[model samples]
Target: MFSLRTISSLWRTSKTDLIVQCQQQKQRLSSATFTVHPYKLHRIDEGPSTEVTCTRDQAINYYREMTTIRRMEAAANALYKEKAVRGFCHLYTGQEAVAVGIEDAITKKDAIITAYRAHGWTYLRGVSLVGVLAELTGRETGCARGKGGSMHLYCDRFYGGNGIVGAQIPLGAGIALAQKYTNSGEITLALCGDGAANQGQVYEAFNMSALWKLPIIFVVENNGYGMGTSAERASACPLFYTRGDYVPGIWVDGMDVLAVRQATEFLAKMCRDGQGPFVMEASTYRYFGHSVSDPGTSYRTRDEVQEVRRSRDPITMFKENIIQAELVTSDELKQIDVDIRKQVDEAQQKSRTDPELPIEHLYHDVYANMIGNDIRGITPFQRHKHQNTSKPCNITI
Candidate 1:
């Protein structure tokens, strides 16, 4: 057995500061004095082998895409100040890696379903910034043709930004079922927030996925809150990885792009190999509100938020990791930033002048067929008036 003194010293060095120090210290002493134990210390330098898959160009692309999401949201924030884009807009500022890293493990054929804060995922999946911006501004060119706004952007293989708490979980399972039925080599990735972890539908989806052996990955983007309430307050099983009791789960360091990618790649492979349902609880934080209208800082302490931002900023971590590994240079990263800013500026300019959704489209996407009962309330004349207008305003609730 290792001596208690040696074990105590090791435990002190290994555990997080947030860990219950006294309990951990006591446990360390007991284990050292009671039994022989063997363990290996791993270094961050000894990362997952497939990180090499992230080449210079891939790293540059990831960096640029993350930056564009960040800058675009910042622009949206600025526009909100100027009273341009209205209604509930949730920015994926600090949690970019949760989306970007997961996407690294997926293909265009794979499907993704997520909750309200979904701009990052849509953009990563190739939804043009012009479309997303116009959607935020309620222009017809937007992903949901301006009707869905921030909480409901959709694209090919991207299900939606579902507003209902955990409703998208089962929808993701259904998509996976379709993939299974067709024997398509594709997996469905369903994303949920820390708050939505408590929703009954999530567990229902978990049960369904396990029963049918669906190729689905349930990812909990633990951004620390369900609206104004923290995860600690909402979930009895606050350690979200274990929430999917029947499904195997992996807790990932969501702030590290490489970590998120490595973990996701592992989970994705498991699903691809017909391992059925898997869960990934990515530990991340967001810098924005439950929505654009609310100031995020009001509920959470700035110091707490800043601590995570300073230490665990995903974009910074990616840059530092790449530079340290000799994968990219500081100058190259700066150039990427420049290009991204220009693209964002161009997209912003285009969104402002875009026209609103035409009346035909409003009725077109509502259902496969426009039933008489659907438009029963609005008479022909009122419908004609709405249809003739080029821009529709105040769709916000």
Candidate 2:
């Protein structure tokens, strides 16, 4: 008969050995090279091509980022439901691939501007999870200092979560123009939803961008519907990639992270090569409503939503691919999920306890230099002198 202490000692040794072996295997996989399967590009006109290489590190990072966005959006949905977040909260639940893939392909110097569905982009662009959650809850610690709310979050190079539909399109082009003027060699990614694609200003920006040969990549996230109206019912031409007649365009599977990255890389190169602006239509889907207030089911069926979620979820698809390639174990990915959930939970708790922005903040970031005019106070004709003398308040209000 074996002694109990001896048996326990043997079990511990075996467990340690197994753990060490797994770590060694993971390290080996991390250093290994892998090929990303290519997908045909639906090109409006022929352009330069680049091969996308997916490695263990890239897969792991993509998985982590996409999962983080998914979990963060889930937290935002709950916060909105609980009334902790208010005023036009748009969750980026199913469109993680578009943001993550773009960020992966571009450098930090490159700028990005997007519509209200922007939490994922903000996070990927270097905003902390706490900052994003705090912004949503209107806390003083928010990225926008509690003023922008869910519709406005910003980082160093990221422009905003612009509230107005189709507004960011022209604004993005303007940013690209500045980049070109400075000879920064940086490109700008201007993202808009399918609903905003038909706006007149977008075409005008496209024409100006093409004429000036600005470095801008117009990414239209075609998520099927524009609010409650289906894309089929809304636009005469649903293929947004082909909408830019003078500018070259490509259509890609937005659900596939690698595909999105490959397409973005190709488009970004074209812009850098002085080919002017390029258009990419990413065929994605939003799992949640346009906003928290929207039920998102009047025009679409519940089964249709469920089917997309099951078949084409970007996070799930990435996870499956990485696991199948033996780049990472299921347990490793589950651990990442567990860690992200805990991080989000902590951020939510902290945001709840953070103080709200003070009333005087309204007059703080209004101008670059001190203007001699008095801002109107609560009582009409009673004006308060603006005291802020900061140089170049370049922050987008």
TM-scores across all candidates?
Answer: 0.80, 0.88
Clashing pairs in 2: none
Instruction: Per model, state how many residue pairs clash.
Output: 0, 0
Best by lDDT: 2
Candidate 1: regions farther than 4 A off: 1-53, 359-361, 369-397
Please give, for residues 256-309, the per-residue lDDT of candidate 1 as tens digits: 666677777777887889986888888889887888777777778989988987
Q: Model 2 — which ten-residue stretch has the worst lDDT? A: 31-40
Best by TM-score: 2
Q: What's the lDDT for all of these models?
A: 0.78, 0.86
lDDT of 2 by residue, 1-397 (tens): 8899999999999999999999988676774333343433444445334345577778889998999898889888999899999888998889999898889889998999999999999999998999999999999889888889999998889999899999999999999999998888999999999999999999999999989999999999999999998899999999888888877888888888888888888788878888769888889999888898999998899999999999998888778877876878899998988999999899988888899987877677666665576777789978876656334566432
